[model samples]
Target chain A: MGSAMGVLLDIAGVLYEGDRPIPGAVDAVRRLRGSGLAVRYLTNSTRRPKRRIVERLRSLGFPVDPAEILTPAEAACDWLRREGYAPHLLIHPDLEEDFMDLPKSDRIAVVVGDAGPCFSYERMNAAFRELERGAPFLALAINRVFKDRDGKLSLDAGAFVKALEYSSGTPALLLGKPSRDFFVAGARSMGCALGDVTMIGDDAESDVSGAIAAGVRAAIHVQTGKYRAGDETQHDHRPSALARDIAAAVDLLVETD
Target chain B: MGSAMGVLLDIAGVLYEGDRPIPGAVDAVRRLRGSGLAVRYLTNSTRRPKRRIVERLRSLGFPVDPAEILTPAEAACDWLRREGYAPHLLIHPDLEEDFMDLPKSDRIAVVVGDAGPCFSYERMNAAFRELERGAPFLALAINRVFKDRDGKLSLDAGAFVKALEYSSGTPALLLGKPSRDFFVAGARSMGCALGDVTMIGDDAESDVSGAIAAGVRAAIHVQTGKYRAGDETQHDHRPSALARDIAAAVDLLVETD
Candidate 1:
């Protein structure tokens, strides 16, 4: 790719699967960075902190830095800090460690995600009560399912987020993939305009359509990890290009350049 | 009402609000019974067993019998028993006592309701896994909201049921108030044909339209409990009559008779 072309990469299904890295993904990242392309990792994963995700990538032999990783937790934490809001987080227990740096106060804002074992009726109702009392609702992502460690598709955070929305009649502010702000913020972190960046990932809706909607220069769909057959055809948004995998996507980018 | 005119009454909004009975509701039931009308209490309440519900109504000074009280749980339990399906109950902890009489086996069927404090990601995912494995999804009721003890509208079982449906790509068989089968079952239990029965309730969609669709002779919408000001006008199925409350509903039925 050209030196000025920035790229946003998805993590869970693109570069790695659970603790294992996708084949040729680590080399593809190296090749993209070697080509002087500005690259940032954008993810909707709410189960782990950004530091943990970075550490995981490094352990999997991928060259990922803390600054180069973008997650909804970070975006939510930033939004919370910037707005001076005290959030009542209903996220995964492992993800709670990331929001400890925010200011603590009596003000309550309801934040929801795939809380895993941490999700309970008490906590959900607590969040619902806050929403009923006019507190703001923030969602990490509405992705329906995620591939678990056992290689099985498990329910994601979207169901619970939607449940709360349906119950309270309050729309949630999505701060993760498919949300234009999350995409634009990632591009901004790379010091590039939205129109100058390209997002490449397996999830057609979250990564591809989300980036395209945010006015990113282009979005590339990779037919690896979590890429369902005919996903590109089913969705309303069209991907700018399609590749066999992350490695092929990198090659396509470079060849097009 | 005439001796042959059977009345199907909705309990939650029409006769009671949480633990407390609506003013004059007990007297209305008594008057309807005194007039020699066949009365059946059709409810969508899944938080408690039918026995407990009947006891609660009795405690609240309503002349309700075990056979006179019909709930979605009872309908669902009956359906399960008839189909010889072993049920994995995802319902309120208190409601578990109701389905204990079902035959035990390795054959897994998912039965869902307002699980209340029992609703967790693990349990929900377990149910989703069962649905994915081709188990039938049975829902007690899909009523969007219910009036709570504090008189505020609270989230009901429908939201979770819908979440599971959306996630697993499975449709739930509703065995509750809005389902025509549930309404017909109540009429059948009363030894009355569907055309000889009248349903009276505050919820327009579940009680009124549901009965009308099931071929009930008439449906009455009451302006009490959770009834919004214009709910009767907003729905496509017009209630045969509109009353101010339970007392007025009984009066309207008798006067028309």
Candidate 2:
């Protein structure tokens, strides 16, 4: 039983996509559930409301509590507020709703993302126009690309953010991934201090380093996610443990400690 | 006024996006009208039908006769056919019509582009299956990023192509941009030989060098468009001629010789 050491789950690739479950993903979740680990479904599904994310996960055979589903949108809104960046931002147009809690202004923050086609000239113009008028550019995650549905890759938000960086010469704040605050927020939202938590995920950049930065006692990296490029010799390396899959992740946690 | 040397206009940043027009860009085409220059919009608009492109350009401001538009799509399809790569496998999902002219089945030469979100496991699976079945990976432009309407840049087709590159360790046969055939296609559209022409455009990598590769007598780098880094030193350190704007471009031609 993993009740003593908690586990966090990543949704998209680890859980399900749209309606179909990834191969063997449910069994992995069930195995974790059977172990009694506190399962938090951490997701960057800013596109969907939290309810949908939870409902979808439940439908896919995962037991997810409403309070347990975490999203970057929430962290983004929180980070914006905490940092005192003016609320009204020309955020990625795709994430207009993410900023619903933030105050709005006619002027916009500088626009950037490898996020999607959302980086269109219209979105860039809106962000650039606001930035041109003295709005600061606060960008989200800057990963070069995101692994797509088919487990292949495409440029992610970072590429677009860098494009604006080259164009505007303004550096935006990063809210998620490798940013300490995201892990801090995750723990804070879980109503626990980072020192008490055991964090595990597939990405070293976001999971391990981020957890470490926020003071998580331990971090486990699963080789299956973004880090399928998982050579520890690469830059940004170092985790308490590494595993090929979720099952391996739980084993690493048990074995390492 | 431009018809004298036989105009060799570059596409990409110069003319259209996908199959659409850049804002206020119709003016360039309108200006080209009756300018007495043998005008041809030479493009690397890979994955598009030139006929459709001509129609799109006319709606945007080009007096482009469909016959006047030179595309990598045509050249690629042509190359595929001649090399007996006919009906070559197309990796890109967007412009299948471009390949329709090719010999059907068993002759599919290669697949191309970054394939976007569709570059999914399924898409890559399909490409790999074909490649496993002996299809080559053919690419059009391998641009790393493209500017959105917002002026922020996002991933280009290169990222997807790269994954396939990683997966197969096979380089793609590029069919557009810096390729020599691209420049030759431009001149061919103008009814001129490469050595007799001058190449003009914004992107130094794809346009200037491509012009040089095609044996263009000269190239002028415009600072306003694609290669505008706000700092010229970072780009191709040497431009045959540098102009800050289009008017400056015209002035450079007048003053140079």
Candidate 3:
């Protein structure tokens, strides 16, 4: 395969895990950027707005600009604007700032994210009502579970999305990771062709397998964050390379180039 | 075909639509009981305990005894006792009374029901933790939607059950309607063979098709609550007879005998 012209870097596990940056993650991004490769931050995290995510990255000493980050919330906003539909958001309260610029209209869509403790029955019912009334259902991501702040696996937005789908008898349009369009969007944002972009992340399924399925040049799986011992073998589309962490993945990319 | 020797009656739609009884439903039950057929009430409702359910039936002028009512809550309790596990109940607060008598232990099983307003992320995550730790997942019912008090379709326990299953990568054991074992238990309670008991209800899929699949003698579909036009055509197992309402279903049952 050809070398990567651009890179899609997963934010949470690859850079930091629960408020602490992975060893050498900050220097790795700088070295990769110094190599003249276009880099874009892509994340499935739905709990925070893009600004807050950028701020978090900055706090950890990563040289990231707000424009360099791409989130599902931004993609969802673009889709909402393109479709001329207003959203009834079932999302975490912290993420509300991303969709503030969308025009309000009577044609509504149900947008679901990881609402965390905000996933109340009343909120779910409200979203269900919107879907039942023929509103479009847009899900940010459908990852089944995520490592919670307490270091335990907890239900993610995907589970709640499945619930709403079951209740309303309506299928949801995915706007985040594992969606080919999401990876393509990331590639497009950096003016890179799908075949010239590589993804680096810890999640084997959504980050590695998803990028491979999306026609990226390669995906480097990192053994950090939520990576389990046998996670790499779980999906049919395996990662192109395995790295100890993002720093190791950067070394492979830089040395290969 | 042989005539029905006993009956399994669905509570919500067949007997009443919301708080109002279907026309002649009370008299129909009286006539059916007078015909010497063993009768049992089967419901999937997990919002209330058996005592409250019986109270509501009495308030509606139905001659329902608590001993004649069969609910998934009771079934779940029985199963928990048999398996020697204490339940970590993710159910409506109103239904806690039903499980209060069970012995408490660390061998916890996650029991999910229609929690209505009680479905919060904290509760769902707690249940997920139990499931992740090798706890058995028991769902009271998995009906997709239910007609709410507002006369609008709302999400039922099935939606939440699906969410937990998606998150934990575990299949749940069903303890309510549409579970063949549930129907068999209803028949067994009435001292009748499965082939000698008929089911009467409005839900084409759960009440009618479910009983048919369970090998009941017959299932009478009534056109009342939640019975949309062409519902019978939606399922592969057609009801033995279609009646305008529960009263008509009773007339058909009594006359055939």
Measured against the true two-chain complex, the DockQ scores of the candidates, in the order shown, are 0.55, 0.05, 0.91
Docking class of 3: high
For candidate 3, write residues A1-257 as lDDT tens digits: 33689999998879998889999999999999998999999899999998889889999999888888889999999999999999999999999999999998889999999999999999999999999899999999998777777777788899999999987879999999989999998999899988999999888788988889889899999998888788888887899998999999999888643
Model 3's C-alpha root-mean-square deviation from the true structure amounts to: 1.9
Report the TM-score of candidate 3, chain A only: 0.96
Q: State the lDDT of candidate 1 residue by residue for B1-257, as single tens digits.
A: 43337999888788887678889888888888888788998988898888788888889998777988888888888888888898888998899888888887677889999988789888998898898789999999987677777777667787798788877778899999789898888889888998999999988778887778778888989998788787777556889888999899889767533
Residues A87-193 of candidate 2: C-alpha lDDT, one tens digit per residue: 54434455565566676544344433333544344454455445545677766665544466656644455544554554444667776555667666666665666
Model 3 spans with C-alpha error above 4 angstroms: none
Pairs of colliding residues, candidate 3? none
Clashing pairs in 1: none
> What TM-score goes with each of the models?
0.86, 0.58, 0.96
The number of the candidate with the highest TM-score is 3
Candidate 1 lDDT by residue in tens digits, A74-107: 8888888888798898998888898888888777
Candidate 1 docking classification: medium
Better model by DockQ: candidate 1 vs candidate 2: 1
Q: Which is better, 1 or 2, measured by lDDT?
A: 1
Total clashes for model 3: 0
lDDT of 1: 0.84
- Highest lDDT against the true fold, candidate: 3
Candidate 1 vs candidate 2, TM-score winner:
1
